[model samples]
Target chain A: MMTKEQILQWLEQFADAIAQNKEYLTQLDAAIGDADHGINMDRGFQKVASQLPKLAEQDISSVLKTVSITLISSVGGASGPLYGTFFLRASTAVAGKQELSNEDLASLLQAGLDGVLQRGKAQLGDKTMIDALSPAVTAFTQAIGQGKTTSEAIQQATAAAEQGMQATIPMLAKKGRASYLGDRSIDHQDPGATSVYLMLKSLSEVLGMTSD
Target chain B: MKKLINQPEDFVRESLIGMAKAHSDLLKVQFEPTFVYRADAPVQGKVALISGGGSGHEPLHAGFVGRGMLDAACPGEVFTSPTPDQMLAAAKQVDGGAGILYIVKNYSGDVMNFEMATELARAEDLRVLSILIDDDVAVKDSLYTQGRRGVGTTVLAEKICGAAAEKGYDLADIADLCRRVNLNGRSMGVALTSCTVPAIMKPTFELDADEIEMGIGIHGEPGRERMTIKSADEITEMLAMSIFEDIVYTRTVREWDESKGGFVDVQLTNPEWEKGDRLLAFVNGMGGTPLAELYIVYRQLADLCAQQGWQIVRNLIGSYITSLDMQGCSITLLRLDDEMIRLWDAPVKTASWRWGS
Candidate 1:
């Protein structure tokens, strides 16, 4: 069971992952976006850092909700709203629960994607964060249905997210300013998808059953 | 990559200070808490007109701050919406006892934050009216993000509505005029090159040299289409045709008194060039396009207007507003009448703006 403490740790880790990969993300964004992907994601998670102490004692849902609001308000640009919506939906998915069950985790992940879609209005082929998130969510569902443990399902989801992120390199963007490039939008990596992959990567590394 | 700045973070503040220094006779920079206000603002008995958004969209919201445009404009970080705290401060400081009117673009954060500021001001018993400008005929309306965006047309809305306010129109009348301008104007943009935000340190998006993205948002959000780069005439035709279609299909200029007239017989006045009744033309730059290029576009548009049998009355040919360093321009026309022409000619002083002053 992932305790609320573990959840906090994961949030902190999420922030850390963004900080560590900030430059890489920005480099990718230089191609498809305004090159603020890493900067915004880093700034948003950093703000999420200050709230950690206050969030530590709260319910997991409450803590995540705070992160969502902070991100939406401070992160700015398109990424702020996208990541903000993700956490808000994640919080809703885990509502009234102290810790997530295996099924609960999958539902929460799916719910987060739903929030992303609701906010960004991006879809699978749009070459946005949805590309990474949708694939990850599908993988999680499939793995869990195959009787994989919670840890195993997360690993599968993480791999799928990474693959989905990779797949964005060749697809043309149909949403956002990047879409303005039309066919030229292809070949460059989607920054939102890259960040989503990082998010799933953290999940898999932190909670997956490595032994399995 | 070498920009005229000491530090990227301090760009907006330092630039505002320079603007205030250079145009102190017309513009005043509020220190400590930041914003750009007209030196003649808080006009005793008049309603305050406020508009602001992100910083990279320069000369907009700020360049329009003057006698006939904005009373005050709050600047936020690059391409980011200003906070409610900033908006509230502007709302309070610019209140002239009559009331305050907010001209907000139809972006998500801007709308939410401006709405919050309006609510907060209401708590203080200040009468505030707001008109959301959603004039871009690009993005489809959705339950999440607002439909279309406030784009080049914001300049026309601000100028026209600011004129109404200058005429001592009441808050309600000014609000109605603003809404009317919003209804009348439509804009579409094409980007030849992507612009880079200083903080972001890279182009907002990628656009190949050989192609152009049509229907792009000022935020550098992905556009709807990418087509082969076309000639100035072809591009002008596409953009102007889109705007005309929006005006016609939206029925923005339908005859109010069908019994009195067929189509609205409008007359353009305050002619920038002595000519017959054509229309008001604005050949605006998308930040990086040169004035010479813009004039070339103006020539094409003037030809277009001549071809349409529309007399070119008043024409503004320059970058009145910009979208960072994107290399392109937009064509905007306000089909005006006698009153609008008088209002357009009204003297106004502001940062990077002076008309009949």
Candidate 2:
């Protein structure tokens, strides 16, 4: 079971990763988007980071909900509502869970993917955050179904997410500002997909380190 | 990157503070969830007109908040859509017991946030209706992209609709007039350079000295095509022809149905423009472009419309809606009926646009 402390660590790790790669992500977006993906995500997560302290003693669901609210209010782009709904739905799935079991984690990720799908109306291969997140959730669910530990499941999910992000390099975007590029959108990695990969990677790192 | 701002993060807020102070006689600033409301808001027995978007397009939302324009304007971060809380609060503060009409642009972020605000405001039992202004003909369709963005036409819609509300038109009539304004308007723009978002402190796109991005949107999104820089008349012809050649565009948008107490989708179609139609020609500068250049564009646009047998009955040439420091201009051709011309000529006293008082 993943403890509340681990959840908190995951959020911090995600925030730190976003802060570190902020320029790189913005550069990726500059190629095809409005060139503010990194800036927007960083702004949102920074607000979530500040609110994390007050949410430390709360239930895992409550903690995630707080992050969702902070991100929604602060992010202010396609990413804002998409990621906010992600966490909000995940929070609902894990409602009342102080610690998450493998199945609970799988459910949380799946719920997030579903929420993003509903919010963005993006399907697989749409060259959006869904490209990474959809695969990550499926991998986590499959890993957990195979009796894998939370750490192992998250590791598998992160690997799939990385692959999914890279696969967006050849996609013609069908949604968001990037879609304005049409064929020109091809050959560039989607910044949203890259950020989603970072999210899973951060979560995997937290769970894997705790397992060690 | 070389801007006159004290801090990068405080860019939007600081500008808003300056605007509030500068326009104190006409408007007042509200904090927490920042919004600029009319100095004498909650105008009893009038349908309130509320409009907002990302802040950099100065004189658009905030500057237009005054006597006969928007009742309130919510300014988001540089090129970022404002959150629903700001709109909800603005709606609560400005709702004059008649209703509130939200004029939203066609950007996905703006559409989604306004949708949420409409839902929340309705939940609070405040009457509300929303109409989207998507008149940019740069993008072709909604099938593959976010569709045509709302650009020059949005400013015109606000001005016309705000006047309609001032004339004591009910919420439904105001919403219909706003939608009609959007339907009859079409705009296209070009960019000589890209603008930098202050927080990022870098240009969104790089353009070579000789190259121009044609059909550019307000947010510096790449246009339909890029080409070598041409004469003002040639560029004006390019923008004008695109609008003239555009087919009848149709799309479905959402609106709040007070009687049904839920949202309903309304199919809207912008009709084809016929020859000899009287039009309101607007030549707008994209921030960095000078007035001399805008007049050059307007001169070309006026000539082209006349060549095509269209009459320029009324014209507004200036920097009404702008991309921050992007050196370019957009031409908007809005077909005007008798009612529209009457509303367009009505008195408006705003910080940016004031006449007929």
Candidate 3:
């Protein structure tokens, strides 16, 4: 079971990952996007970081909901609504649960992915966060179904997410600003997909520490 | 970035504060989710027009907020679309009991945010309608890309739709008028240099001195292709022909259905332009380009229109909508009917644009 501290750790670690790679993500975006994905995500998560103190004692759902609201208000790009909706749906899925079981974690990830798909209208291979997130959720659920621990399931999910992010390379974008590039978008990894990978990686890192 | 900014993060907020001070007689500022509205807003029994987008596009959406223009304008972070809260608050502040209409651009963020705002406004029992302006022909395919980006013609739509609202048109009538304006408009732009987003403190894109990005979007996104620089007349012919020789564009967009109380998808097509069509010619600089350069562009644009047998019945030539410090220009040709022509000529008293008052 994932404790509330683990959930907060996931958010804090995710924010740091975004902060560290902000310029790199923006550079990836500069190839085929508006060159602001990292900046926008960093701005959103930084606000989330600042609000963590007030959310520490709250339930996991409350913390997730607070992060969603912060992102929805601060992040102004396509990433904003997409990520905000993800957390919002995830919060609903795990409502009132102070600690999340392996199955509960799978449900949370799957619900977040569903929210992203609905908000972005992007399917697999659309060169969006769905590219990474869809496979991550699938892997997480599959591992959990096989009776893997939460830490093992998250590790599997992060691996899938990394592969999904790399798979974005050579795919022509079909949505968002990168879609404008058409043929020119080939050979560049999607910024949104990269951020998704970072999120899953952060979650796995947090789980590895707590469960071990 | 050598800008007159106090801090990178404070750019949009400080600018709004300055705008409130500068245009105090015309508009007032609201905080939190920032928006600008006419000082004497909620004009009784008037269909209020609300529009907004990123902050760097000066004199657009916000500067155009005054009598006979937008009743309220929401400004987001530089080059980022505003949130639903901002739009929702703006609508509530300006709804004068005659309903409200939202003029949204076609970018994904703007479309999604405005859509959410429309739903929220409907939930509040506020009468609201929204129409999108996707006039830039920079992107080629609607099914493949995010369709066309809204560019120069948004300013024209705001002016015309704002005027229509001032003439006591109801929400539906004004919404239809705005849609018509979008359908009849086409624009194409070229960027000579990239602009810097204040927070990022770097140019969004890089262009070699000898090359130019053609078919540019308003937010400094790269265009369809890049080519070596050409003469004024040559570049003018290229940008103008992109619009003039463009075929019919068909795409699906969302519009607010008041009866259904939700958004419904509607297919829209750009009306093809033909010879002898009376056009409102707009030559807009992309911020860093000087007025002299814009005039040169306009001169060539006029010659080309005359050659193509199109009549320039009215014209607006300047940098009204811009990318921050980007050196470029866009040309918009909007087909005008009698009603549109009359509305375009109507009096508008805004902080940035004023005439016939």
Model 2 vs. true fold: TM: 0.97
Question: What is candidate 1's CA lDDT for residue B217?
Answer: 74
Candidate 3 lDDT, tens digit per residue, B224-299?
A: 7989999988999999999888889999988887777777789998887888999999999999999999999999
Query: Stretches of candidate 2 above 4 Å error?
Result: none
DockQ of 3: 0.65
- Candidate that beats the other on DockQ, 1 or 3, i.e. the better one: 3
- Provide i-RMS per model in Å: 5.0, 1.2, 1.2
Q: Mind giving the per-residue lDDT tens digits that candidate 1 earns over B206-265?
A: 667698978777766656687899998899888877765552222111111224422232
lDDT of 3 at B169: 94
Ranking by DockQ: 3, 2, 1
* Model 1 error, position A142 (Å): 6.8
Candidate 3: give the TM-score of chain A. Answer: 0.98
Per-candidate TM equals 0.76, 0.97, 0.98
Clash pairs, candidate 3, are: none
The true-versus-predicted C-alpha distance at residue A59 of model 1, in Å, is 4.8
Against the unseen true structure, what C-alpha lDDT does each candidate score?
A: 0.75, 0.89, 0.90
TM-score of chain A of each: 0.95, 0.98, 0.98
